[model samples]
Each structure stands twice: as C-alpha cells, then as structure tokens.
Target: MAWGANSRSSSRSSFRNSPFSDFGSYMVVKNRKLQEQFNAEASSSSNSCSNSGKPLFHGVSIFVDGFTVPSSQELRGYMLKFGGRFVNYFSRHRVTHIICSNLPDSKIKNLRSFSGGLPVVKPTWVLDSVAANKLLNWVPYQLDQLASETHNQPTLSAFFALKSCAVSVDAATRLTDQMKSEAEDPLLKGGTIKGDNLS
Candidate 1:
C-alpha cells in the first residue's frame, strides 16, 4: 500500500510538470490580470476626459455600421469615454459621421444623398483618436470603396478574382496604375467614392 501511494504521488508530480498541465488555470490568471489592467486604464482615461472639461468629440454624434475590428460595443465605449454620443440609427442631419468597415450600396447612397454630405470613416479613426488623446482629422482614417465589376458596388477586393485568367502586360500595368492613383487621391480617401462612374 505504501509503495502504491508513492508511485501515485510521483505520477501526479510528473503530470503537473507536463507541457499541457495547468494551461487553463494559467490562462485564467493571465486573463484576470489583463482585465484588471484594462479596467484601470479605462478609469484613468475617463477621469482625464472628464477633468479636461473639453471632450474630444463633445458635439459630434456618430453612428456605426458594419464595424468588425474593435467591435461596435468597443467603439461605443471609446466614443462615450471622450464624450461622444453613439446612436443606434443613422440620422442625416443629426449624425455627423458614419463609421464602418463594410457597407452596402443602399446605405452608402443614403449617406451620400444627405444634404450635409455626411463623412463615412473607418474604425481606426476612433482608435487613433483615443491613442493620440485628441480628435485627429478623420480625413486620413477614411475607408475608400473599392470599385469592382458590379456597378456602384463596393467590395473588400478592388479586382474580382478570375481563376487561371491571363491578362496582357499593358492591361495589368494600367490596372495597377489606376489602383495606385485611387489610393493616393484625397477626394477618394473616404468610405464612399463620390463619382458617378469610378471604374
């Protein structure tokens, strides 16, 4: 019985030291610490914003659509922290900017048709502003609509993929040049391109 108990104790010790052992517990502890740290930072930033008496986005009302990077909730938290109002619905006159990573043509048209010419920006605008401790210009953080084969349709990829399709060198060069020009143009920088025919 004593020998058996000793053997069991050794086995348990070996298991504890194994590569896979205690992984869950280790992660739990690490997560707790990270949460604590984040909470502390958030509290401090909130205090700073309040104390400043001039929040970065005091007058700006924002609406989010199709944001995937930091999540809508996370974006709201940042906006609220800096005294910005987050709205559930998009208002042409009331909402100043629409933040989105993805958008449909109907939604884009609705924003564009607005008399105010509502600016549509990417999620990085919020994140970068928070990091800079000020409202950086949204112009640089804007997301451009990549004109694809479909008319007035925006997609993540600028060119539609064609499996085993061969293209002339001149066509490829022209396509590359056009893409480069689009990227550099300030007018086409925002979430939606304004032209009636972009491609």
Candidate 2:
C-alpha cells in the first residue's frame, strides 16, 4: 500500500503502522536535555546570591517543520546520513514537547495520541527545545532553482542543497580571483591578502 502525506495524520492506526512517522519523538527528546539543565540551574541560582538572571531556551529556539519525505527509503537514507543522533536520543524518558513546524494539525494529533499510549508518561515533545544542537547545522533545505515536484536523489540533492555556509557566487568569484592574483605575483614582488574575507 502506498502512503500519502495525509495518511498517518487522520487515524491512530496509520500512525501505529508506520515507524518513521513517530521518529519526530526522537528529535523532541533530544531537544529537552538543555531545558532540564536550565531549569535545574535556575532553581539553584535563584536561591543563592547569584543575582544575575538569565533566560532559558535562550528566548528563542530552532523552530523546525517536518514533512514525510517521499518514502521510507528516502527517510531511511536521511537517517543513514543525518538522523542517527536525532533518533538515538529519544531513548530517554525525560524528553517531551516536540514542536514540529511543517506538519499539519492532523499529524500532530495522531502523534500526540500515540505518545499517550506509551508506557512512560512523559509528555509529547511538543513546542519545546528538548533536543539539543544535534541537527543544528545538519538539517535539510531545498536547492536553489530546483523543482520540489521531483523526488530528491542523494547524488543530485547533495550538490545543490542550500547550506548555512552558502555564499554569493559573485563574492566567491571575487575571493578566488584575489587568491589567484596573489599566487601569480611577479618573481621580484610578493602579495599576501591576510585576514580579509574579500580582497
């Protein structure tokens, strides 16, 4: 049977039948460790003479949205590549409050109910920074000028995916030209463009 984007959303059965649909739980727990640490520190510091107050969850968190990647094969491949650490941390019971950004309310509701069925009573990882920076810079994004209609192939997507380290082609080209000029200086002269991003 083929699964559509809305499949696991409506019924608890669909959710239970699929393992990957519940994978977000793992990411949720991973986000909670720091929250627990912050709460603990707050309790101690509030009682002591350390009057300097600090905000926990640091006033903002990495808001993420989830989409059922085209298929489990893609999902598993994503796991092989980026989801290992994200999945492993869900083993902890303290994690709860997963905040998924892209998923619709239907999917969220199904996952919520599933968590309710678990043996442990930890709340669903909803709207919380339970997961740390595990996927901090490793999350996925769309490639520029690509159509989302086609399935993303690892070979092609790896080359075009947008990254946190992205730079403008002009800026990049300029930097390359500067480097080439420095390297090809006259035999009697020398040039070194030190510490400048673009020179």
Candidate 3:
C-alpha cells in the first residue's frame, strides 16, 4: 500500500511505500552523547539491536514487484529475528566523522512514530561525510549493470571452481568478457576474490 512516500515505485523506492517508509524525514545520527542516550533507552527493549550506536540493519537496495514481496518480507522477518536492527556504520565515536558511506541523496534526519513509538534516530548523521547514501542508491544499478554484462560476456572460469575444472564454455565465457572486465578495475585488481587465482 502506498503511504505518504515517494512515487518512484521502483525497487529503489519500495521503502517509500511502507508505513514506516518515512525515512526521508530522518538523518544519519552522529552525536555520541545522543547515541549513547538512544542506546540506553533501547537497551531494555526486546528485538532491540543497538551495537554501541551502530544501526543493526544495513539497507541493501533491491527491487520487487508484488509477486516478489513475499520472499522479501520472509527474508526481512528472518533477518530481524536474528537481531537485524538497522545500523549506520559511520558513527562518530569510532574516531572518524564517518566510516563506510551510502548514497548521495541520503538525508540527515530522523522519521519515527510521531504518534507514540520510541523515536528511531536516523543514522544519516554519521553517513554524511561520505558517499554512503550515494553508494546506497547506486548499488542496485551497479548490480543490474553487472548482471546485464555477465549475460553478454564469454569465458571459461565461469565453469571451473577452485577445483581447477571447467563447467561450460558459456559459463566460463561469462567469467572474463562478462563478469571480470565488467567490474571497475580497482575492484578486480584488489585481490583473489576478483582474480581467477581462486582456482
């Protein structure tokens, strides 16, 4: 159901539709004293996951039509069951103004139950000094781009695992022309994860 949220109904905007969808009004939190207070208040609450001011839930941008929602909801619930509280990794007490970043449009505000629920401080405060919000918004597009490229490339590594055997020409073809080169070089050059050296 669409609430008072953004109309960009794509997967990127799915959060805009939920009742708890008013994250726009929220900003990333940074004040150490405020976080400490927030943590103290929530520490007694069940299902509360305040990791010394870290938001337990790290939003991963994903897409979903109605049919895709059931699985999403199931996974969401499952994650929350395991203490998946939302977290903003850029907290200040960590000796930096920010840590890992998100998207650029990331707002710096908090949106919670203006009615009566315990207010949820947005983690934007810490996320500010970086592209964290921008990264958040960019992730989906990047993954989609990767998948599209993966579908178009050709290689042999795709078929072989660390066991040093081949799977299929189509699969391996995807490894080089499809997946590897598709990613930014810095990422590919970083380590074995991107390098075929795994096998």
Candidate 4:
C-alpha cells in the first residue's frame, strides 16, 4: 500500500536502525540540559544581587539621547534590568555617561561646567557590557577621547554619528528598492473582473 506498491513486503521499514532516532534522542537530552543550565544561571544572578545588597550599577547614571542601535527605550530597559538608572537631564552631578550617536549642541554648554571630563560614549558601550554580563571600560567606547579637554568639557566625534546615519540611509534605500521591485512584478498586477451575461 506504500507508494501504490500493492505489496506488503516491498513497503519495508524506512526507519530501521536509522540515525534519525539517535539524533532525536540526543536533541531531547541536549534541550533538557540547556534548560537546567539557564535556570541555574538565572538563580545565581538573582541570588548574587540579593546577597550583595547593592545594585550592579550602584554609582552610575546613564543618559540617552538621539537614536541608538537598540533604541533609547530598549537601552534604558537593559540598564534598568542590570540595576542601573536612566536620567532625562544631562549634568555632571547627575549623569555619569551620555549615550548617543550624536551629542546635541545645546548640551555642550552644560558639559563645559563639569569639574571633570564627562564620558560621552556610544550606545554599544551599554550593549557590549550587557552582553559580557559585566561593566566594561568606557575609554574604548568614548566618542570624545581623541580630542584634548583642557576645561573639563566633553567632546564628541562625528565618526560614529556619520556611520550610523549612513547605515540607516542604506537600509531605507534597500527597503524602498525592494518595494519598488515587488510593485513592478507581473504576478502582482491586478486582473480585470469580467461579468458573465445571464440573459
């Protein structure tokens, strides 16, 4: 009856001692182990935070401006998840770091009043640190590290901002091109409806 063979003998077992059986069993065991590991890690992290009686980012306050890789809201959520605080205002006393692709011109005056240099870093500083599950040094991600700061003023570089803008433009251009191509496809062309004569 298999494939219209009309013979029982010809319909031999396709799964006889097959490797697929072993693979399926292996996958089940692997999945179980993975779930256990994840649970253990989550519990450990939670326990550590509770036992220390201090948040991971105890002394750090982060401020987000402009558009970022994970979006400002998502970035803030990540920070909050890691026991960090997000601030709306930018000040040396309040904000420890300014996370943005571009530093707003208005903030420049405020940055000048700081006693020490303000760390203006890219959003990847947050993302990478989260990925590593530890706080990372801000020097590598600082947007204004190269320029000299004599008056404790924060400096920003156009390199990361321009790159982010170019990437966004490329993505938008690609989306527009795809839409245009889909519109020009013959299968997408609407067919005319015709009425049948009943008289």
Best TM-score among the predictions, by candidate number: 1
Relative to the true structure, candidate 3 has a C-alpha RMSD (angstroms) of 23.5
- TM-score, every prediction: 0.46, 0.19, 0.19, 0.42
* Model 4 collision count: 0
Off by over 4 Å in 2: 1-55, 58-92, 104-106, 117-199
lDDT of 3: 0.34
- lDDT score of residue 49 within candidate 2: 14
Ten contiguous residues with the weakest lDDT in model 4: 42-51
lDDT of 1: 0.69
The residue-by-residue lDDT of candidate 3 on 1-199, one tens digit each, is 6674445556455665644445533433334444455355445444423343433333321211123223534433422432332222322223111111222222211211111222111233222212242222322333232334447865566544633544465578877776657465655555535535554
Q: Candidate 4, residues 1-199: lDDT per residue as tens digits?
A: 3666755444344444445466577666665674465345434544213234655555667878667887887865665556666665454666788887755556655555552577778888887876666678988887653233433643355667778999999999999999888677765545432355355
Per-residue lDDT tens digits of candidate 2, residues 32-83?
Answer: 7645654454454422111223222222222122543233233222223321
Candidates sorted by lDDT, best first = 1, 4, 2, 3
Lowest lDDT sum, 10 consecutive residues, model 1, at 158-167
Candidate 1 lDDT tens digits, 1-199: 6759988999889878876457676665665674465456555666335335688777767778875588888887776677676766555655788888877777666656662656678888888877777777987766576223224655545444332134566688899999999888967767576667577
Worst 10 residues of 2 by lDDT: 120-129
Query: Which scores higher on TM-score, 2 or 4?
Result: 4
Q: Per-prediction count of colliding residue pairs? A: 0, 16, 40, 0
lDDT of 4: 0.64
RMSD of each: 22.3, 21.6, 23.5, 24.6
